[model samples]
Target: MTGLDPELADATGKMLTQAVAEVVGDDPPVEVEESVVLGNAAEVLLERSCGAELLVVGSRGHGGFSGALLGSVGQHCVQHARCPVVVVRGSVS
Candidate 1:
């Protein structure tokens, strides 16, 4: 949806499903649902955060400074989300 190529979107969806399955395994402790929504990433996440228990985001630190801890979207969510927010970063090897 939203300008994404059909094949790419299908592949992305499948990949996300597989990743979630791998994480949750056969019997997840909590309910799990997978969906794909195309829009401004931050705006979409904020809208969906209305009643979420927690919000988790990944930051590649690809913003202005390479050594920065959070990207713009993660920072925005941390400041504005109604629920608790967690920012996950790549492991320091």
Candidate 2:
């Protein structure tokens, strides 16, 4: 996962775990590696896409609506990911 701020990465990971549990019932054991990429969203997505089975990301990030309006990382992944990409959007409830 790529986050401009390190603090946000922890929150993002928690949110992702919860969201995944909601859909998948129980969370599976999987290896998650976090990295810091200092670049644009497109660049980040490109770096991870190579040789990846699937690139998963949140639909809306820390920027919320502003990020949505500006085309989120999810959007960039959808367009550029070499393999299949899953974008998870949080629900109101």
Error of 1 at 58 (Å): 1.0
lDDT of 1 by residue, 1-86 (tens): 77888998999999989988987898999877676778888898888789888788888755577446687788888889988988
**Candidate 1 residue-pair clash tally:** 0
- Which residue pairs collide, candidate 2? none
lDDT tens digits, residue span 1-93, model 2: 443576777766678677567666654566454454557767777788898877777665445464563355667778878989877656656
Which lDDT values do the candidates have, in the order given? 0.81, 0.67
Against the hidden reference, what TM-scores do the models get? 0.75, 0.53
lDDT of 1 at 67: 49
- In candidate 2, residue 40 scores what lDDT? 79
| Shift in Å, residue 4, candidate 1 | 3.4
Off by over 4 Å in 2: 1-28, 61-70
